[model samples]
Target: MGNNHGSLKKEATQPQHSTTNNSKDEKKIDSRTEQSGKTLVDIPDDLMRKIIPYLGLIDRSNLAVTCRRFYEAEAKAGNSKNSEIWDSVGIDEKGKKVSMYKCFFEDVDDESGRYSIMRTKRMILSLKKTTPATTNAVIQRIFRATTATKMEKLEAAMQLNDCHSESQSEED
Candidate 1:
């Protein structure tokens, strides 16, 4: 009976192995587990963008921190919601001023996992200044200038027109 019990215990226990070999097996298992799933990167861009709007601000920030691709997708999501931003702009009944304040993430450093959320107070049309009488036209231009280059060009053209009009009034 004692011999039979000893044999049963031996069979129940795993055979002792070198620590080095055990560690190697553990590493292999770890790698397999790590490689098993489809990560966020596996998701298509259109699907990712679609997913972004459903997330709240903090959730968006968390998603942005994951990788560059996600960060860009989040930013693009913001851009695509231009109508929401436009609606948020405060415009009184009078065509005097249209103001839209925007905050967005920029300057993402993928390696260091550093990013910046920049807030801009845009005075699309100012109350004190004599802006376009047609608020619709001004709003259209504001929304259309999606890129920095486009915005800058729009600003330059507006400035040039202002200067020319001022000179014409002076001549009169």
Candidate 2:
């Protein structure tokens, strides 16, 4: 009877250990995948933090697809508290100013807008120096951005016009 109890305990503990190990292995495999279709393990968090602010949204999205650590670092660096990183990309402001500045941009997720404006300006500057072959691609990207902004503005105007018409109809 004693020997049977000991064997049962060993059987229970061994499966638990294996299941835990299997879960950890799955997480490791998932986190090691890279956006560039390669497997990379254990990129230092400090290096990711340092490099993250310099990347545009597209670059960050590409990098985050590769590793869990990079994705966390990107999320941390996106907010107002990371103004030093934003300043490095040419949107100059102290970290303390972020909260107050954000209040004025209440209509949208202002962090993206600030980052986009800075990146677009930098891209425009870069376009000035690129060769003719690269110019077309750059121009297309800029045009697409401008077109999107215009469409947003047009949509807003349409919404406002609809509101006025509806209110006038209600009065009638």
Candidate 3:
């Protein structure tokens, strides 16, 4: 009877200790959540709409692909200055469309540069008579030309047996 009483007392004490640990763990979790910065989902849609105008095409597309909320927010924000840019790009079989910037843009020097390019691309077509097809083809041509130049250099080097002397005349 004494042993049973002792065991009951231990079980009661064990639960108290476990409950204390659980409360500590919960506090830690709460502190961690506070320490973690706000995610995109945490931002209000109205605020996001205001911020969308400042984001470049790539950044906007990235946010759109992050989740459905961002995608909806972007579509409603009315910041899509160049709607035709999306038309030149095709949708995958899964009904997902890749961003034109990712497919066509070679390099973006910096955020400011990217923003300027985005602005130019948006405003240029309206001012000019060129169609999106023409613009896409021109961009693709530039990439092809760059690739061809690299291939030509590789071929020339291979033909030269990878040896190109910097100095034409040798001094003894």
Candidate 4:
């Protein structure tokens, strides 16, 4: 019975399995993620854009340098809202769909993200601050120069020449 007691105790206790391999793999993944940067890079651009607005400029700039994907995504997600930018310019109708346009950051249009007036405007404002001021007669001059307003004028002219077209079109 004394000899059987040792075997019974051994059988009753569960064997402790070593986690050496798993620990090594986990450590590797942790180090790789830290070295490569945050795993947030894997998120989709649209969703990322919503999250982007909540981050301050400093944080955005930091994340921007993380990777090429983040840079492009950050640029697209900057202060601009596609509809607001488009509507403000009066050129919303010029582009078939703003979402389809090429993003400024990416040279390759094949997979480039959406264009952003907010990003463009931000750049313009930064430049404006550094340059000498040129006092224009009125802000109206600036408004007319916008691409959207220009396009709207061009469309009006073309429709104006089309006398046979319905007069109802002019009301728009």
Candidate 5:
């Protein structure tokens, strides 16, 4: 009976020891995984900035907010040169003209309007100089016509009359 009791005590103690060893092993593995994750920190700022232009507007915005370092890096890299970045400036898909400084200025308050206008004008000037003359003429005509007829609904309607509207009422 004494021998049996001693053997039982040994078996229970051995299992407890093994369990403690297993827990330690698990902790070591967890720590190693964490350290491996930290290894990604070695990526350079320039590479990260280069990658920012490919990201969507929301992703870029969130990433910019992540740290001031990232913001400066992105700005230095000219990530704002990416066309998608203009979405934050409130130029929607319909108004995405390289020449439309007004769209950019309209989105910001008066305090920032001058800067936005200057930046947009610079971007427009940087566009390819060889753009077709016909395209320029058409755009200029549209701009002049729109500005001249802005407050006159009938004139605006007359200007658009040549444009085909898909609505049945307009067709009639």
Candidate 6:
């Protein structure tokens, strides 16, 4: 009886050991599967430009810091004259016609992450133009006033234009 009992105990312990070994093997297989799924490669430049605009300014900045490829991509995209991508984000182009006041109000009203990018872009432009101090002061004033009066004045001008158009129609 003692021999039989000893044999049964050994059999039970063997299965438990086998199960543990199987689980460990399963874990190793899972790890390899996950690793195989991870492919490290450079993102295409055009795709990166499109994606950068959608990302928040901080995220875009961090991406630029990741590699020279990303930094160059961002700079190229921002400087593209045909794109107007930077202007859409409220950034003024270098040596290009831009309403400083309009850009300021646009930046102030823009709550999107593009605002930071616009500000940074403007600062860079200002530095290039040697007017950083003046530009900074103008931006501060725009923010302080919230551009409310400017918006109101624009609305008033539109209303006057509408009235003038209606009067001219009646005269016709």
lDDT of 3 at 146: 23
Worst 10 residues of 4 by lDDT: 1-10
TM-scores of the models, in the order given: 0.33, 0.28, 0.31, 0.28, 0.30, 0.29
Model 1, runs deviating above 4 Å: 1-37, 44-50, 54-83, 86-132, 146-154, 157-172
lDDT string, candidate 4, 20-105, tens digits: 66655455556656687545655667788778777754566687666555565666674633323323433332332223232321
Give candidate 3's whole-model lDDT. 0.41
Q: Which window of ten consecutive residues has the lowest lDDT sum in model 6?
A: 1-10
Clashes of 5: 0
Cα lDDT of all candidates, in order?
0.43, 0.41, 0.41, 0.39, 0.39, 0.40
Tens digit of per-residue lDDT, candidate 6, span 65-170? 5555555555544333222433332233332333544453355346444443344334434332334343334333323322235455344434433444454454
Tens digits of per-residue lDDT for model 2 on 1-172?
1011112221111111123545555554454352343433244556556667677555666765554444555655533322333332223222232333233223223435644444444444433334443444443444344335655544443443344345345456
TM-score of 1: 0.33
In candidate 5, the residue pairs with backbone N, CA or C atoms under 3 Å apart (3 or more residues apart, or in different chains) clash, namely none
Query: Candidate 1 residues 61-166, lDDT tens each?
Result: 6876665566666766643343354443333334433333323212111222321111112223232243343343444443333223544645644643454455
Better of 3 and 5 by lDDT: 3
Model 3 residue 61 CA deviation (Å) reads 0.5
Candidate 5 lDDT at 67 equals 52
Q: Pick the candidate with the highest lDDT.
A: 1
In terms of TM-score, which candidate is strongest?
1
